[model samples]
Target: MKECTGVGEMSEMGRLVLLGAPLGNPADASARFREVLATADVVAAEDTRRLTRLARDLDVTVPGRIVSYFEGNEERRTPELVEVLAAGYTIALVTDGGMPSVSDPGYRLVRAAIDAGFPVTAAPGPSAVTTALALSGLPCDRFCFEGFLPRTPAGRRSRLRALATEERTLVLFEAPHRIAGALADLAAAFGPDRPAALCRELTKTYEEVVRRPLGELAEWAAAGEPRGEITLVVAGAPPVPAARPDDDTLRAAVAEREAAGLSRRDAITEVATAYGLRRREVYTIVHT
Candidate 1:
């Protein structure tokens, strides 16, 4: 008999299950979610208190060992949880809201279980990412999920600048207190005219989706500190064809590039390609 930290380590067979929690509304809890919550042999959660509260709200009593498995202890608890799994028990993983391992805990334990050749499955439920995107009024055909922006203003701005030319729609998470600052940074990086939507308190009583250009959104958010969780969906960069450079413009640009350190031949080639003219023509211009 061995004692592992997280939950039941008494069994000899092991498997893992990740359960998605409701973001805001408890009624959104599904039947299967309730069943698993009540019957799991061992339950591990990002917040054990939240888990108990959820079970109470759902009118279900968890008949299993309850343990904490959140961010601060993921590294410490993964091995312990893995041991319980290796010991022939079913360990259910949950978070405060939404899918586990998505801007939440569960990845480490899942990875360790897989590496140990243990069975891993999930009870998929509500997700803020998909919910916000569906109501964002932006093209969802091709999009990217950017979980959360950097806390620092400068760091966030730098990250946004790198994504400036990204063509796919973007989904981002932000804290309530920092939403205004984040929106302002978005305006600077993506331009004031870029279209975007701010999703607030999704699936909750005060749920709201504000759609506007980046500039307007920044100004609106600045009015006051908004409450609740925030998700932002930004329209992809508009496709623009490179302009055909005129002869004079090409020559001037190439000269400027050369003065800035490009080789003469490279400068000629660069200008010719930009203007869709012959390299020999630019060579003639540079020489003559």
Candidate 2:
């Protein structure tokens, strides 16, 4: 069997280490994360200030050069980071919280590094997605992570409508200020009775998780918007019961089939089989 190469094994070309920072608590950072931050040749952070604060909190010194790499600058910064990788200098990418490139600024650099033939790996750590899912008491067997909802109300509603029938549990991230409006729209689109949980400031000192129906959650948010990072876990849509065709519809089906060269008896059989009914039942309806 082929063996998996370790992240520490650096080739002539330096690797890109994707670091998953603590969701909120600095203590959640792993030992490998701290080591990478301390020893990497370059640390590309979504927010340099947050990275500095996190380093300070973890008692880790970032000896490498630090640079701002965010949404606004990702396109321009990716090439430079790749160039650093080409120079045999390991580049560690960290976001403000959680894993980078997860609705964060790390995709471009990852793609660039891979395309440039540089190795890319991660120092796995805490994530708000799984944290919120576990705390929500929702089924995690099958789920989807929708990083953030559309910024505009119309766009959000449109997106929600498309997902209304999704059977798998749904997870989403929302900004503090937009939490209220997002909840309201969720209730409107997914229906009031849909079960959901709201997770805030996960893994932090004042963390909160509220499990409620969409209606109650919307009402709660309307009363007062909760602060801090918001993660929403919503139950999937309930199974829709199949409706049996009525007398008029059954008659129409027989007539349509008869018009299509099927005999009345054959049409009744076809319609009965198609609608999962006995031939006698369809015949009575067709005759009556």
- lDDT per residue for candidate 1 within 6-111, as digits (tens), equals 2334445576878989998999888878887877788999899989999999999999899999889999989998888766788889999899998889888888
TM-score of 1: 0.80
Pairs with backbone N, CA or C atoms under 3 Å apart (clashes), candidate 1? 11-87, 12-87, 12-88, 13-87, 13-88, 13-89, 14-88
- For model 2, the local distance difference test gives 0.89
TM-scores across all candidates? 0.80, 0.82
Query: Each model's RMSD to truth, in Å?
Result: 8.0, 5.9
lDDT of 2 by residue, 157-259 (tens): 9999999999899999999889889988989989999999999999899999999999999999889879998999999997675678889999999999999
Deviation (Å) of 24 in candidate 1 = 0.9
Candidate 1 — number of clashing residue pairs?
7
**Model 1 spans > 4 angstroms off:** 1-12, 242-288
Task: Point to the candidate with the largest TM-score.
Answer: 2
